[model samples]
Structure formats: C-alpha cells, structure tokens
Target: MNPRLPEFQTATATDEQKTILNEILSGPRGNLNGPFLGWIFSPQLAQHAQRLGAFCRYQTGLPLRLSELAILVTAARWRAQAEWHIHYPIAMQAGLPADIAEAIRVGAEPTFAEQDEALIYAFATELYETKRVSDATYQQAVGRFGHTVVVNLVGLLGYYALVAMTLNVFDMRADGQNSLPFAE
Candidate 1:
C-alpha cells in the first residue's frame, strides 16, 4: 500500500523541521521512517512525540521483554500491521514466545509460561478492550512492576497507540513483508 502523504523532503524542510529531523536521525531511531514519515509534516508534534517515544522505547523502567509484550498487545488491539511487523522480531529476540505472538496476531488467548507475561497481557488487553483495568489487574501490575514502571507502561501504550494511528492512517506498512498479520 502507498502512503497517503509524500515522504518528507529534506531539501524543502523548514528550519524547525530540519532541526527535528536531525535530532531524530541522531537519536536511537537512526532513520526517517514509519510514523516519522507522516509526522514530519507537523514538525512540532513530531518533535514532542519522538522525545516521548524515546523514553517509552528506551528509557522506561520496564524490562525489554515486558515492554515489547505491551507494544505487541497495543499493535494487536489496533491491528497496526506495521507496528506488529517491526516489533515482532524485537519481541522474539527478547524471548517472547512465538506461540504467544501468533496467538495475539490471530486474536486467540496466548498461554504464557511466565507470570509476568501473563500479567502484562492481561493488563494491556483489559485496558484496551474495557478502557480501564479491573482493580485486581491494576494491583497486580503495580505490585509486580512497581508504580514507576506501571506509569511508564501506560505511557508506552499511549505512545504506541499514536504510532498505530499514524501507520494505519498513512498506510505506512513495513517493507519486505507482504502477508498481513490481520485480515483486511
């Protein structure tokens, strides 16, 4: 699928856009792609979102496995193919079981070996489906991960939701993968 908007043209970038672009390029992302392609049209939003994303993706207290699980849940909830395609490998590398990921892709209940994975999956899915978590789930997450990580988890979910929206709206799919994780 083609993107709804043209990719950002560095040659025609405004000073503000250029600065933000440079920051993004120099940051952990190291490239202009994904939602960055859509966000460059609004440099201010791009700047703030990218900074927040940096925190959510890298600086969050949640361990890589937990963080990736939450991200995959968000991608599945939103049916954001690009988000799924990009993070699936990262999640696998972090030791998230392929069976679990495959379950999420197909909207089945994943049987998790680790208690933490089960907890995260429950928290994320509850929050997305019901718009709020039950007290048991909330207490479990806070007890397991602490207040700071719980907060970061929420922020991470919100940020990824924004990414999913951007990708879905602009049709910014991952390159080199043709099969859709979700049926259209």
Candidate 2:
C-alpha cells in the first residue's frame, strides 16, 4: 500500500510543526519514520506519541530485549510491515534469540531460552491474540516483574499497538521492502 501522507520536510512545515519535528530528529531515533510520518499531520499528537514511544522503547521497566520482543509480537499480530522492518533488527541487537525472532516473524511459536522471554512472549501473544491475558499469565508476570513492571509492559503493548495500527491504517511501509514476513 502507498503512504497516506507525504514525508515530513522542514521547509514545508509550520513553525510549530518544525519545532516538534526538530525535537524528534534530535532525539535517540535521529530521524522520523513509520507512523511518525503520518502523525506529523497532527503536531501535538506526534509530539505526544514520540514521547510515549521513547518511554516504551527506552525507559520501560522491562529490559530492552523483552521490550523489543513484545514489540515484535505486536508488529506481527498487526502485520505491520514498517514496524517489523524497523524493530526486528533492534530486537536482534538487544539479544532476543534469532530463532525466537524468526519464529515470531513467520507466525510460529518460538522456543525461548530465557524464562523472562517466554513470559513476555506468552503475555504479549495472549494480549494480542485473545485480547486479554489469563489469570495465570497475569499472576506469573506480576510475581516475576512486580506490579510496576507489569503495568509498564501493558503500556508498552498498548503504545506499540497504537503505532502498528497507525502504520497499517496509513499503509506506511519501508522503502525497498517488498512484503512483510507474516501473511494475514
């Protein structure tokens, strides 16, 4: 699918949009892509989303590997091509097992080497596939990570899901990529 909005450019932006865009550009992401391109149409929403995304991707209580795993689950579930293209490598760099990542990419169950990875996989997949996690899964996560981390995990899931939805709705895609790994 084609992009619904044009790519953001400083010269064409209003002062407020430029300010927000510059702020995003200077941050860890370094450049805007994916849903941000479409979100820039609403500067306030873009700013707010970027901030939330930063927290989910960087500051969440879960480790980077776990967070990236959850993000991959969301991306695959949504068949979000751009999101998968962006986060798959990041997840690998963060130490998510290649086989596990590949399994998720292909819509198969992954064998996790770490218990934390397994729990996160179960939690994320249950949340996405069933729309709710079972009591056992909830308690297990809470027992291991505590309430705050669990809350952050949920927040991460919700935030990325929003991003995936935005990208899908806009039909945003990575340049030069032919198709996403998973089939609908």
Candidate 3:
C-alpha cells in the first residue's frame, strides 16, 4: 500500500480525504503536483495501465455502459469502497440503471438491460469465482460483442481490477464531495 497524499494536499482536502484526494487532485486528476501520481508514481504499473486506458477507450469501443459494468464489478469483487463510490455516479451517467449500481455497491446480483452488461457481470463473476472464465462464456461474449470488444472487455476487467486492488491496498476512501447516482 502506497502513501495516500503526495505532500501537496489541497487546501480544502483533509488528511482523511487525502486518501481519496490523491486520486482526484493528483495522480490521474488534472490538479497534479509531483512528476507522477497514482499509476505514474508506479512505473511498473504505468506501462500496463497506459496501454489499458487506450485499450478500453479505443480498442474496445465498448461505450460507457459496458465499461461501467466492468468497473463496478471489479470494485465490488475487491470490496473497494473508493472505486465503487466514484464510479457509481459515472456508471449512471453512462446510462446504467441506478438500481443496478446500488445493488453492486452492496454485493448484490445486478439486473441489466444491456446484453453486454450482463455478459460483463457474468465474466467478472466467473473470473472471481474460478480465476478463469469458461469456454462457453468466452464464445458467447465473442459472438455478442465481436472479438475486438471481447478482448477489450477482458482488458477492462483487468484494468479496473488493478484500480480496485490499488485503492483497497492503500485504504483509499471516497472524497465525500461527490454526489449520488441520480443527483443533478
């Protein structure tokens, strides 16, 4: 687990919130201080992470729905409150149902309208349960999403899994200033 803040904590951000602040203001966020933060602070993880963002955003073309689904599952599987807390609203903004996001926060089976969401949840569950997905599930995903999306979905799971673990390992918490799922 790495230290939460990089030395220059924001004026409004508390030390408690610094855990979450590290993620929001620095590291990945725009208001960065140090040369590297979050993934950048970790050179080894950065190589894989940079490629992962590209893979999820470009290679997959998964859109926000499936991407959010992949992220939420990774958060829940790892009990990562911070990741779940932030992505909860982002997922809804991406068009996922509020009910589904809430269910995911507390570790419940999520209902879905998008076929890709269901498939992603299934894949995440399978991976968490057995450490590997079955051939039938893989085939179904490939058939439904095509090979490129399937590949990126896998990447999404892996990338978000890294995020969840990183947050958890560092005891990261949410910045409380964030709004709820449907907040305007």
RMSD of 1: 1.1
From the highest lDDT down, the ranking of the candidates is 1, 2, 3
Of candidates 3 and 2, the better by TM-score: 2
Instruction: Give per-residue CA lDDT, model 1, range 10-54, as digits (tens).
Output: 899999999998999999989765688789899899999999999
Q: How much lDDT does candidate 1 score?
A: 0.91
Give the worst 10-residue stretch by lDDT in candidate 3.
27-36
- What is the Cα-based TM-score of model 3? 0.72
For each candidate in the order shown, give its overall lDDT on alpha carbons.
Answer: 0.91, 0.88, 0.67
TM-score for each of the candidates:
0.96, 0.93, 0.72
Model 3 per-residue lDDT tens digits across residues 23-99:
43443344432122455545445545554654564457777777877788877777766677777777888888888
In candidate 2, which residue ranges exceed 4 Å CA deviation?
A: 175-179
Candidate 3, residue 120: Cα displacement in angstroms equals 1.6
Residue 10 lDDT (model 3): 48
Higher-ranked by lDDT: 1 or 3: 1
> What does candidate 2 score in Cα RMSD to the true structure?
1.6
